[model samples]
Target: MTTSHVPAGAHPNDGHAGPRVGLFVTCLVDLFRPTVGFATVALLERAGCRVEVPRHQTCCGQPAYNSGDRKEAAAIARQVIAAFDGYDHVVVPSGSCAGMLRVHYPSLFEDDPDWGPRAQDLAGRTHELTSFLVDVTGVQAVNDQRHDATVTYHDACSGLRELRVKAQPRQLLASVAGLTLLELPDTETCCGFGGTFCVKYPEISDRMVTEKAEMVASTGADTLLAGDLGCLMNLSGKLHRLGKAVSARHVAEVLAGMTDVPPIGAADGGDRR
Candidate 1:
């Protein structure tokens, strides 16, 4: 497999008077889907945000938090908080990582008087990319881009349930020209890539993703889109194995009108811009 490809985003603070924002590029996105991160920056820039990629940033500590390792997670959380606390807002392309900052970080430092308030502050500003676009900036639509494909949008578990991110992405997708939006059956159903859950319970995860692949194929959509990279990878992986001719992409990539990168799970470097 090829390494993730990073796109060159416009420099933040490029003499623009937008809100100072930090882009929290998640681990999976950094290693496997860098286009999502770049697309996020593009969307933010278009939304009037001066986006910065904090060099000190690391994982959101979700792996440790979910594994019941609060000590390590908290330590990592402190580092993350320090890295992003200076920004006016912190945005993430992946909902799970956003949830880590928006929901879990506060809980991680609840008992500490020092880091507790800091965590709460960061949590309050952190938002999923689509949610930030719609709810915060009040931007109803993105710059209309031409993508003539019927696509199904998967509501990743965390973004849908945790961040309440159902309408924001759909609302933006509506603005894109020549894009037909098809609803995935049971769109809210988990893709069974619950971070480490798939690793621990491969059989059950496979079963769930198999059903998801079938539903995605059933939609007759040519493309599969989701806000979370992990879910995209899981569902895309299953669909690939089943020989489904669907292109999987992050919603940010489409919303940002980026056509230069391959789809998330393309086997032969397909979906080139």
Candidate 2:
């Protein structure tokens, strides 16, 4: 979507001396929702990070890795490792991608001698976006952004179970003015978008997401927010099919005040910008 990396001097490196963050804009965010990528950059810059979108960055090989294709996954992981080398931290907007980098990359190379050490080093620095802002940068609040909606948060499985991203996004959302967060029923349940899992078992996936969407609707919140785009897209599509009124968005959009674009799975399907 024509998004440029945050170069030096674009934002002052004040608080944390601008940790070099290599933004791993996931494939979904890059193709379906570019606003999330832009919002992530805004939030990182606000927290005093010198961000860069490495041109060589590609998919985290999550689909292949999950599909029992270790050979291809390892090849892609090697490329990702090389692309994000030299950065102080590699931050991803999606928890699933971040989890792959932080949790799975090392295991993929554990038996190897050369790439194994490199994978561990990179994994240590990998972090989800909200977690990086709150934990690594010590950012307590977001400034100048407000959402006056009755919002419900869905705990994406990867972010919640894998990365323990339970409270980081909520902690920041609490700082947002005019926002009311209503907890969703069974927030920890999967929305059924397990990377390639949905494609493999559409019937099972649809059933799970249908239940999740019903839970979201039961919350009676006007908006639904989640850390991972995959979950959001799955729920958003289900909600639309059910004719539910809730709008779905990446949490970074509201936190960074970049919600001028249409919500995910809108009737018009949103622009690529």
Candidate 3:
């Protein structure tokens, strides 16, 4: 819904050298697919932003917070806030993680006057990767890598509903030379990988993902791309199990021309990985 690149500002300023951006590598990207984090760095640096990865970073605390453990969640939030407080802005590769920082962090510190303002400040400056690229830095294009396969995009729940990130990625993808952008039918629908939801209700999650995979296949896209790793993993895993050959990758990898890594949920013991 928002095409403005300012991250939190109504009018983004791209005139000076890029703002100092602290890159928060989400837990999934850190453990399962580190290439996405690197690709994010590639894109951010290309946008003229000076990016830094804090060494003391940990989980975004969404699991604990959602589980109703306010104490542990607040502790983790404070640590994360302290780690990146000096940066001009904080950018996250995953919308889920960015949503935690931007939407939930302030609430975590509501009773603490000292930390509440800091949390609000961090929230105001934090942005999802694609949003930051298109809105904050005004980057129109990245690397010139072209895919031979037709690619369709999936709108992850958090990025679509929480961040209102509908158009920025499609706008940037339009400029990818030789890359065919096929819009998936019902792209905004959830793929049922709601972090803990899939684990709590496997049958329901499987049914939802089955339909989502069917939608992806209906588009005849050889490659499936999305901003959130969770949704990509869910859909790609289902596609793999169904014996479908749809390849999946984070949008950042494609945009940065770093698609050499294995696609999400690649078949075990396969050369594609």
Candidate 4:
């Protein structure tokens, strides 16, 4: 619900030499973890981008789209497209939302001669954060950020398959000073938080997340990380219920050195940026 340019006063870099980025802060991050939004700005700033958060931005409408509500989804997509019309690039912290904006939005309006071109234009400019940093900005490393914990990573389905975000996060995490990256078995598998999928099929969703949580625990890593908050929150809850000690966080938090807050779903974690 915030149109603020940056979360918690995270400003762009001094020179503002890079592309002007309009951050598409997803609903999950805005509501559940504003720190992820803060970390996103910090990471983008560190990568030399001039970042802005447009106040008029709203949901990417994945839920409605996934539910086969094309009319409502297109209405939402047009709002997002209009809100972020002028940025050099649109960056999102969550791959799910980014995929919606980048991949699905065009198809949602493919038949509409008026909105189709706009959706396609917006789609071309949209990118997930890690991919934007590594692939677009040529940022190969994260400097001055160190997390001394052994961690495993999960590749959310949309980002991994739709956007091909496999090695982008790994490439950046490699630069963290004291961080050890443990590769999760089946890292590319879906975490079952498929927007509304989990809600519609709770039994199947629970089974998938339970297995995914077990895989995370098997790594024996102290922390779990991914680019999408929805997956992290789902797996975090499952891990907590299963009594696992692995903490879950967004990759941006570690990359931006913003892990002072407790892990997602930790009882002590409050809504503070």
Alpha-carbon RMSD, each predicted model: 5.4, 4.8, 4.9, 4.8
Instruction: Encode model 3's per-residue lDDT on 1-273: one tens digit a residue.
Output: 122222311222245455788999999999989999988887776666778899989889999998899999999999999999889889998889999999999989988999999999999999999998878877765545565668999988898889999898888787677789889888778999998989999999999999999989889888998999999889989998998878999998887777776788764556352
Whole-model lDDT for model 3 versus the true structure?
0.84
Clashes of 1: 0
Model 4 agreement with the true structure over 1-273: per-residue lDDT tens digits: 111123333444566656799999998898889999989998887666788999987688988999999889999999999999989999999888999998998889889999999999999999999999888887777766678989999999999889999899999899888899889998878888888899999999999999999999999888999999999999999998999988999999998889888889885754212
Which has the higher lDDT value, candidate number 3 or candidate number 4? 4
**TM-scores of the candidates in the order shown:** 0.93, 0.93, 0.91, 0.93
User: What is the clash count for each candidate, in the order shown?
Assistant: 0, 0, 2, 1
User: By the TM-score metric, which is better: model 1 or model 3?
Assistant: 1
Winner by lDDT? 2
Q: What's the ranking of the predictions by lDDT, best on top?
A: 2, 4, 1, 3
Write the residue-wise lDDT of candidate 1 on 179-230 in tens digits. Answer: 9999987887898999999999999999999999999999999999999999
> What lDDT score belongs to each candidate, Candidate 1 first?
0.86, 0.88, 0.84, 0.87
* lDDT (Cα, tens digit) per residue for candidate 2, span 1-273: 111123322466655476789999988989989999999998888777888999987699988898899999999999999999999999999889999999999999999999999999999999999999888888777875678888999998888888999899999899888999999877778999887889899999999999999999998999999999999999999999999989999999998888778899875655311
Pairs that collide, model 1:
none
